[model samples]
Target: MPDTSLPKTAADGDAGQGGGPVPRSTALVLLLLVILLWGVNWPVMKEVVGHMPPLTFAASRLLLGALSLLAFAAATRQLRVPHRGDLPLLLSVGFMQMTVFTLLVTVAVQHVPAGRAGILAYTTPLWVVPLALVFLGERVGWLKALGLLVGLAGVLVLFNPSAFDWAAPPVLLGNGLLMLAALIWAVNIVHVRAHRWIGTPLTLAPWQMGMAALLATAVALALEDVSRIDWSGHLVVLLVYNGPIATAFCFWAMVTVNRALPAITTSLAMLGVPVVGLVVSALWLGEPLTLTNLAGLGLIGAGLAAVALADTRRA
Candidate 1:
């Protein structure tokens, strides 16, 4: 998830926890890999929803991802039932971050280009500022406020009449849902910051994913016809890549990087995810990258960078 805490560094020696030594170079490499996987996942997911109903695809991936996480946890001897004290955090993250976020993005990508969808979804950091103020009663510093304004300006640029089609309800709905997904993810981040940890996030991850899998599966069953799916080799490859590589491996890599690098490094590095997503979408999916869209992406990236700087300063 969002690991905004300061880092454990033998290199930079930033103010953070003193954990076991991990080479800075190794951590950076892992961070880069995480970015690649998550960034490429946008286009991959777009392809996935094209092959089947969005919810059904979401359900399948979530189940596979949960199983992968479960296997990893068991192998590491970290598997356990949820602690009562951690239940709220687990449930909040499972539903908001895992299930709802996946569902929204899966559906939204149908109408929104994968590149634009990536930019919109990564607005989670921008939304986190206002959410933290309201939910966590955190004071908004000038940088955070400025970041919020700049980010909103970027969003406006994307939604302006010339950029987005006002007459198309599906387009509007898709963009709105993507924004909602970002907001929901921000809510989870806020909860994560507030909650006292009864179990480590890594330890609780399997349960969270499993819960998301079950909920998505139930919803997909009720709403979607599974028989309509036309399975093929491409779909199987995408599903396997999404579940094991993108979801499970990427999360593990991120957590590892978070523990090893400076919080600022991790946060700033993650901005690469959307950048890679946009580039890959353009190259792989041949999605048109209009000047207006690029301008919006630039503004959002700048805003997110400012927020990351502010967070590092605060930490």
Candidate 2:
């Protein structure tokens, strides 16, 4: 469930200070924390999925988050069942945002390094910017258009033939899957922005998360070998971290930041997730930090910042 204490908008200074717009500093801080949690989640997921099947690991994490949020909603008396009209939207969002996105990412990590996966996933903003313009009727300035081009150039840089032996089908397939996952995420974000679901975050979040858990669990049962799980100590720790901190807490924090910040700004803030993931993976996982990787990161960051700053000025 969303934090009840948090303000739904910055108009009333629900986050403190005067009853004005939320401070940029405060919004940035919250968004940065969200990035950090999500950034670390990649490597954590990679480690855990090493011991468990991808679908099963995703199922466990979602189930745990669902139970935790459900308990919180029940205890706080904040649970509200979705209306008939809202049910399909909520279920579709859950499937796209939670089940398909996580499952594809987990499977991709098995073939690609966590850092690479992080870099690929952050391309979501590139996709979202164009989608937003087309679907949401958001205007894209010349600067943002240039930024989108540069971001695509960065993707091409990362797609060098020498980066991975394309002869290896798994690696090629994994990269494609990661790209598909980003598209799914782009769609989910646009859907959320388009819909007018009438409920507080506390009431809505749990239902979406619970539905995702149930759906993921069902899929896992039908497809994955649950008996093959190693159930090691490291795996347990990673699952706990991914569920409670990364998924549950970060989801709420992201919603809070989104309410306070512009859509482009929020998406730009997520660029940090890949940066942190790359650095952390290099240090902890011994992943190589090559010149091409750094160059790609620089392009991505610059393009994202360009788009974000342009949006902020427009706002």
Which candidate has the highest TM-score of all?
A: 2
Q: Report residue 299 deviation for candidate 1 (angstroms).
A: 3.4
Candidate 2 to native Cα RMSD, angstroms: 5.9
* TM-score for each of the candidates: 0.79, 0.84
Give the poorly placed runs of model 1, Cα more than 4 Å off: 1-34, 137-155, 158-161, 251-272, 304-315
The 10-residue segment with the lowest total lDDT in model 2: 1-10
lDDT per residue as tens, model 1, 103-183? 999989999988778778866656665665565555656775566667667656754556677789999899899889978
lDDT of 2 by residue, 39-64 (tens): 88887878887798899888888888
**Judged by lDDT, which candidate is best?**
1
TM-score of 1: 0.79
